[model samples]
Target: MSDIEMIRAARARIAGNLRRTPLLSAPALDAIAGRRVLLKAECLQVTGSFKARGGWSAVSAIAPEVRARGVIAFSSGNHAQGVAHAAREHGVPAVILMPQDAPKAKIDGTRALGAEVVLFDRERDDRDAMGAALAEERGLTLIKPFDDALVVAGQGTLGLELAEQANEHGVTSAEVLVCCGGGGLSSGVALALEAEAPGLRVRTCEPEGFDDVARSLAAGEIRRNDRLSGSICDAIVTPQPGNLTFPILRRLCGPGLAVSEDEVLRAMALAFRHLRVVIEPGGAVSLAAALFRPEALTGETAIAVATGGNVDAALYARALSTLE
Candidate 1:
């Protein structure tokens, strides 16, 4: 787990390289929810997701000599692009192990960033084992998607930004809805909010079948998803809560909420139509919770972090069709 000090340092380290994504307001969302809802459009961040923060933080923290040896990461998509992008910026080699079924855009994006792409079957192969073997064979550093302190600290920078932006918007208290996978972003933001925006409460949101974080919180222990091969929210389909992220979430975040696949699709379309933002299904989960599960929140001010925008054409088209 990461503390506020680590997050502050990460913010300083990556400040020059990252975009300060805006805190946006949408009247349509407000009308639907009947409250002040702010959207933290992290979908606009570098590599079209917040994963860049963690990737940069981990890569930049590496010793110059170690970085020369290269880095490795296993992700569904966003984190692969993030690590690849960060490695590219530092002139370091990156080898990414990704699911064979990961979004084509993400696979191409990672390759375009100059990383060696290794794809494995999600149903039969173990990504972690493959990544570890490759790292050992090549003397590469494994940058985990959500379980590292460096990555979590880096992700917490969003919480710092959110606190500052909410203050600027005159929001003293709010319920922040973050799409949860293995709890990297949610737990990191939870820690940051606990220190910086004490008035803001963190809530993890997930697709209905993949709501391990929510279930874990409710059960007072870490929980695992029964199956990982079914969700359209590929960006957040981890099998279980991360070892490091789970404790932070359990301590700092409130009971989580979940939304159906249809709700996630509707939220994606709503983001495009009302907020004028392109969002993936996983990225739209928090927004779905905000729009459809308002009763789960307790504050007058609500903010949802739209975490990514890397949807494939087919899924984006389907989401767009929801409005029609």
Candidate 2:
């Protein structure tokens, strides 16, 4: 549903609202990965994640009269803060349903952004049903985290930037690794690259046990994760790939990659050391794959998108301690 045209329109609509995060590279990272590696430091993006792009794209596209009624969304954390910030900017009320065990930093961040935060059990509660009911009751528009076309289109804007940046660096062909949850960012990036930089392919990256996207891509159909709440990569632990995003991923992305929790922590530590960018566990998976799973990659270069930086202080300290 999200094509290059819609993605370009999203970029235009969200112009001046979102930051075009930097594409960074360090010789240290390149040496570790055994290839030229570019890190799209989206962790430095507004709201501390790339989700802001999609949130603004979706919220801004709503009819002005309807947008005034407000909007609702369900996220583990990153998307919650994104939608919350966007709604606050538009001067509309926002209600976000977040998993009870999401990082405390994310919960507080969402509330600080002027959105009412509602907690739900990730395993025992159905967020979809609850979000729908709340939307109907409050006359709010439902802004789906990934399944919406506008959200995908909005996220695709990141790909457009990446494509141009890669070209500027003389990277004509490389594997663009994306930290994928329900595949919103990956699918959107895949779609954008397919048109603007066909030589740059997207590869979905996930934590080992919560690799539904990887397994689904291997099977050529959707596959559900057996458990959703155990991974420390909470920002990206979704039960399944989104219906709208999976097909795009299957068609445009390469084989999905899974990295261990230990690998992710190490990647976070290395990112902080070499790139000076703090990355949450979920956001570090792509870098983990790029650094540790080099056997699966092709070409002489790789691009990894560091998706978020909203980690709890304790967790971040623990990740940093790994280097000692």
Candidate 3:
């Protein structure tokens, strides 16, 4: 199917199955910008993140027999929850592979969604390798968290909604800022935004560690940096950019910007106190870019994708305390 067609099908597939979340506007958020800022609060989405949009869309698109064998997923955080939550709805068994260092909350939450969880030592052994081995051994269909076309299209549905919602809410066009890891969400968001609201500029926000896109865009070549990319904002901590996703984003996105961990935490706090949104470090990243790098979006009304809200309980407490 064509890319637009895939997004259309995903929208239909997920309709009534997911929340028709708001394209929320706030005078407070507007105050941040001389113009205005609209927050697509995907943080409030199912499993507390936008990953659900792609996860449900991709898994459901699979053949019945394929889904019957259940699914295997590799993630450090939010996508794991997305996969597990979607698998639960289909009565499919799921095996999730995660870095042993992944937050305890995500590991537990994945299991809470009724998916079996396994841990790999990301420091010594490769998580992807472990996941591939497990998938082959268990007869599970590996659900690539970002690389899959179905997942990308599924993620694109958000852009479609943003476009439709913007027209309805008096936001005809705006700068779209999305957090990035492997670029699944950013790629889909950019494609959907352009198709839905042509001429939209999409900006990708990344942490310093996995900031490959920013480097590559600057150098005009792929560069890998597996170093620690800020804190446990598991949403955008991809070790490297995806081969399929990078080209699309390079063509679509205006430019990628990186934010510090402090900026991310502070942005997370702002969303909690002002926007009444609870986002993990990764999910709040796009907003972090906005808060710290407004020059990148100078002279435009902006829409930031508040991607996920799956902060560990302890981290949530710490954020709340910092805000207070």
Count of clashing pairs, candidate 2: 0
TM-score of each: 0.98, 0.99, 0.95
TM-score of 1: 0.98
For model 2, give the 10-residue run with minimal summed lDDT: 122-131
lDDT of 1 by residue, 1-324 (tens): 578999999999898998889998889898787677889999999999999999999999999999999999999899999999999999999999999989998999899999999999999997778888899999999999999999999999999999999999999888999999999999889999899889999999999988888999999898899998789999999989999999899888888899999999999999888879999999999899888887777767789999999999999999989999
Candidate order by lDDT, decreasing, is 2, 1, 3
- The ten-residue window of minimal lDDT in model 1 covers 293-302
Q: Give the TM-score of candidate 3.
A: 0.95
Winner of 1 and 2 under lDDT: 2
RMSD list, candidates in order = 0.8, 0.7, 1.7
> lDDT of each prediction vs. the true structure?
0.92, 0.94, 0.81
**Can you write out model 3's per-residue Cα lDDT over 100-151, one digit (the tens) per residue?**
7788877888999998888877667777778778888877888787888888
- Candidate 1 wrong stretches, greater than 4 Å: none
Clashes in each model (backbone N, CA, C under 3 Å)? Answer: 0, 0, 2
Question: By TM-score, highest first, what's the ranking?
Answer: 2, 1, 3
